[model samples]
Target: MIRPPALRPGSRVALVAAAGPLPPGGVERAMDRVRAFGWEPVAGRFCRGRCSGYLAGTDDERAADLDAALADPGLDAIWFLRGGYGTMRILDRIGWPALAAHPKALIGFSDNTAVHLAAQRAGVVSFHGPHPHTAEFPDFARDTFLPVLTEPRPAGVLPFPAGSAGRAEALVEGQAEGPLLGGNLSLVASTLGTPFAIQPRGAILFMEEVGEHVYRLDRLLSHLKLAGVLDAVAGIAIGAFSEVPDEGSDGRPTVRELLQDRLGGLGVPIAFGFPFGHVDDNWTLPMGVRARLDAGAGTLELLEPAVAERG
Candidate 1:
């Protein structure tokens, strides 16, 4: 994968709502944070509003905004306003090859996974990081994020903040290293039979989800299992499965129970709860970088730098 240049203090970042429509006041909020981060915020034509439905605008307009950002020689990076349900719809509309000529950091996760897959195809490293919303990231997320993008050094071993039980827990015991890939479970599952499917032949798959029922999660994982995705990964790192419902009592499995049942038989390193999902303390993961997963220790370490260092 091609390492993009590190973001500097005076960098210019373009904010576009390529996925779901922005919530009211979201653009102004994000613009404030962009300035606080020391980058000039350039809003796309559709960035400030929503359309008739869930999308930020028509596919053509959204595609134009994103394509413009990728083709612009002035913007240092492209950061999404938010992640919702429209990115996958515009995959065909994106000029994927243009990214190679003007490689820059592309940020956002969840529904944004589709874009990340396309960026990976273009051989550019992209960040599975926080959005450019008005809300300030917690100290943990902010501190852990800054160095990875600005330093051009390997993020090295990610530090897990202490928790009541533990920051991370081992589900399967072993150690494996590979390029980290994967985002939201639903997005990963959606790509199973598509041209943009995740090729997990030797990747450390990281997954997280929110607000889904156990049965749906089961179906998604089952799809991966049937497709040989579960069997092919070098390791698995699970993050927060936030705010899922625990309703209905038909002997359904809880999230942890379901995970163990689905992933335990793989004989690969597996760990859960590393704080990178729909939460306040999210960790920014650079897709397509070498990372080490130590299941016994429940630790994930970056094996290589995520960006090219400027002299």
Candidate 2:
């Protein structure tokens, strides 16, 4: 995959609402953050527009905004304003040929997974990080974003804070290194049986989800297994399953137990609860880049810089 140039102070970033519409005052909030990061913010036409209860605008508007942002040679990056559930509708309208010819960082996650798939298919690395509107957009997300997006170097160790458990836990031990891949589980599941399905051979697969019960999570994981998605990766890093029920869940195994049963046996090192997810402390992870997975030690180390310097 092609590494996008690292963002610099003078770089311009376009804010586009490619999926769900921006919430009240969301555009301004995101713009403030963008400027705070020392990058200029360029708002797309749909940045302040809205459509139905969910989408940012009509698929046409979203597609036009994305295409225009890509064609803008002056823009160094395109930060998706928010992600709801409409990115898939405009996949065909994206004008990928243009984006492929002029690659740049397209940052987001959740519904933005569709765009990340497109970037991968086009051979450009995309970021599976926080959206501007998500609470995860600031602290935890910025730690990864600031370094990689500006003064990038090989991030040798990725760490998560110790929780009430008071100590870091390791689900699987030892280390397995490979390129990072995967995103929201539901989005990944949506790609199954589709043309854009993620193919993560020799990859350290990372995934997270929110608002789903154990049964549904099991179903999605099962689909991945059935689709041979799990078998293609070298290791797995499962993040926080937010709002999920605790163990003793309707006579079924808990989310952690369910994961242990399905992903644990992939014959790969697996680690659970390493921060990044639908939460306030999500880290920015670069997709399609090599990283070392020390599952037993509770760490994922990036082996190389995620962005390249441009002359």
Candidate 3:
């Protein structure tokens, strides 16, 4: 995988809204955070634009903003402002060749999973981390994120919070090493049969979601199973599925039971409740980088640097 240049102190970071419209003052707050990190933030032309009820702008508008950001050599990274929906609409519209020619770190998760999958298919590395609109930018998130972008070394060990019962558990205890892949479960499932569909073969698939009911989760997991994703992966890392109800009616299983029923028999190293989804301490994960999953140890460690050193 091609690693983008490490983000220097003065590097320009383009903030774009490739999905739903940004919340009021969302762009300002994001810009503030970027400046706080000592990097210059360049807002995309339509980053704050709103239209079509849910979309940030028309498909062409959103795509054009992203295309411009990717093509701009001055930009060291493109940090998505938010992720709600509409990414699929502009997925095919992105200039992949241009993006590949001027590669920069693409950061965001949730709906931005569409772009991350596309980046993987294009053989470039992107980042799955807290978006400006997703979290409150806790110290943990900043500490884990800034170093990966500014340093030229492996991200090292990523373990769940200490003494937190929400820490990851081994569903299938074992060890596996492979390039990290996957994102929001809903996006992963929705991309099936498309060019951007996640190819989990030989990858440590990481998945997370929010507000999805147990039955829906079951159906999506079933889809992946039937699609051969479960059997092809080197391992599995499950992240937070926040807002999923504890009960299901009509004889349906609860979220926990559904996860066990669907993924417990995968026979691969499986770690659940990883700290990378819609959580306050969402750690930045470098997609397409080789990483080790020690399910028994409840740890994921990147084996190589995610960014290229300055020449």
Candidate 4:
């Protein structure tokens, strides 16, 4: 994938709330974080506007705001404020041709997976990382966010904070080098048969989720299997699956077991638990950049500089 222009310090970045309403005190924290990164944060008008029960604004309003941000030549990036349930609502409304012509870094996770897939379709790389609302204002956000976004090269050997565990625990120990793809399993699976289905062949596929029952996770995996998504990857990495209740040794397969059962036979490198997902310390990963996944070493290293600096 072609990298968009790198966002330099003091660049103007737009903060958009394309999903749920911005929670109380959320935007302030994100703004502070953005300032810390040395970027001027231009909050979207819709970011603070509330419409229905959960959305930030009307579907048209959200889509239009995003369109304006993309079309603005001065905007260096479009960082999503938060993700809940509104992006799909404005998918078709996006002016794809315009976005393709004037690409910018569009970052977020969870509900923002739709936009990531859309960016891929538009032939631009999108960020699958924390949002300003959740990631910007927090301390761990600085540890992961700043390096990945501001540095000239993709950070090497993503390090998890102390006490945090990734999903794959020594499963299929090996290494993989390829572009990074995949996001929340449910979101990726939800795109099946849709035009935005994940295309992860020969790429390092990373996945994580939150608040999902083991059965639901299994079903999503089944969907990927049925759609042949699992068979087309070069390597696999599983992030933290949070909020899953303990099954109490009922003999039901855990999420990791299920992953191994489905992906192990592929003969590719597989590792779990990389300190990513819907959690604090969510490291920012560029979706289309080449990377090496060393399961034996428990590290995912970016193989190339994601952005080029023009002196």
Candidate 5:
């Protein structure tokens, strides 16, 4: 994988909302995150100023805005404003290969998963991290966020937050190593057979979701199985499935039960609830970089730096 140059203090990070419109208070928090990392926040016009429905702008307009940022030689990184919906619509329109020519860290999750897959296809390593466009930025998120980008060395084993919220359990016992791939479950599933479809062969597959019912989660995993995505990965690390609606009285499986039913038989190392999702305590994961997943130990460790020492 082509690691972008290490994000240093004073680095200019372009802020983009390629999917959803940023809430009024969201942009300030995003700026605060940028400043917290000691990077200059360079905001795009549409991410904050305009929105056509849930989209930040029309497909063509959003593509052009993102392309302009990618072409800027002065920019050291591109952090997404938020990931609600829309990046999948403009995936083909954006220039992924050009991003390789001007490689830099691409950071965000949720709807931004489409862009992450595109970046991986272009052979550039991207960060599956929290967005700059957020109404709330928790302190726990910064524990690993700042160091992973600023330090050029391997991030080592990631630290989950304290209490029951940080607990991760092993679904299958074993250890596996490979490049990390995958993001928001629905967004990743949406790219099946597309040009930017996830190529997870020999990769550690990670997935998470939000606002989904148990059945919907089952269908998404079923989609991956049908597409042979589940069969190709070295291991699976399932992140938080936040806010899943309770299915009352039916004989339907619960979210955890559904996950175990679908994946437990795959015979690969599997761990459940390793942070990263539509939650406050998100760990910044570097996609396409080598990593180790010890399912029994419930740990995911970076094998190498996600960035370079020199540009």
Candidate 6:
């Protein structure tokens, strides 16, 4: 993957809302965080614009904001404001060629997974981390986020979240190395059969999701398995599946059981309850970078830096 240039303290970063609109004061809060990191924060014209209820703005407007960010020569990175629900609507509309010609680190998770996949397809590495609009940026997240983007060195070993000893399990124990791929499970599953569908072959797939019912989660996993994605990966790092409910009425297995049933026999290292999702302690992950997953050790280690050294 093509790593973008490492960010400097005074680098200009553009904040754009590519999915849902930010809540009141969300943009201001994000700008403050950027300043705290010693970077200049620039907002896209339509980042705060709302239209058709949930979308940040009209599809064209939102796409334009992203395009402008990509085309700006002075901006060192583009930080997505928040990820709610509209990125898929404009995935193809954004100028991928322009972005590839002038690469910059694109950062966010959830709906921004669409953008990350698009970046991967364009041969650019992107960051899967907490959005700038997060209500509170935990210290772990900020520490992880800064170094990955600013330092031209490996991110070191990332262990499974603390307190996960009760929930973390090794389904397929062993170590596997491959480029890191995948994001929100629902977003990854949604791209099936499309040009943006995750290329999981030879990848250490990482996944997380929120608010999904257990059966629906099973169905999504089933879809991936049937599509040959499950069999193609080198290993799996399962992140948090927050708020997943047991409908109990259907007599279906719980989410954890379904996960084991679907992925246990894949013949690759599998570590569950990784700490990168819609939670307080989310860690930043570099998409498309080669990584090593050790299920026995409950650790994921990036093999290379996510950014290029400043020239």
What's the CA error at residue 33 for candidate 6, in Å? 0.6
RMSD of each: 1.4, 1.9, 1.5, 2.2, 1.4, 1.6
Between candidates 4 and 5, the one scoring higher on lDDT is: 5
Stretches off by above 4 angstroms in model 2 are 134-138, 162-168, 245-247
Q: Please provide the root mean square deviation of candidate 2 (C-alpha atoms, Å).
A: 1.9
Model 6: which ten-residue window has the lowest total lDDT? 159-168
- Per-residue CA lDDT of model 4 for 91-202, tens digit only, reads 8888876766776788899888888888877778778888876633456656776666666686877776766553337688887788898888888988777777788889
* Cα deviation of 217, candidate 5, in Å: 0.8
Off by over 4 Å in 3: 162-167, 246-252
Q: Which stretches of candidate 1 lie above 4 Å from their native place? A: 162-166, 247-250
Quality of model 5 by C-alpha lDDT: 0.88
> Across residues 53-81, which tens digit of lDDT does each residue of candidate 1 receive?
78898888899999999999788889998
C-alpha lDDT values of all predictions: 0.88, 0.82, 0.89, 0.80, 0.88, 0.90
How do all models score by TM-score? 0.97, 0.94, 0.96, 0.92, 0.96, 0.96
Per-residue C-alpha lDDT of model 6 across residues 136-228, encoded as one tens digit per residue: 997777777888999999988874444556335687789999999999988999988888989999999999999988878988999999999
Pairs of residues at least 3 apart in sequence or in different chains that clash in candidate 3: none
Worst 10 residues of 2 by lDDT: 161-170
lDDT of 1: 0.88
Highest-lDDT candidate: 6
lDDT for model 4: 0.80
Residue-by-residue lDDT tens digits, candidate 3, 28-55: 9999888988899999998889998899
Worst 10-residue lDDT window for candidate 3 reads 159-168
**Candidate achieving higher lDDT, 2 or 3:** 3
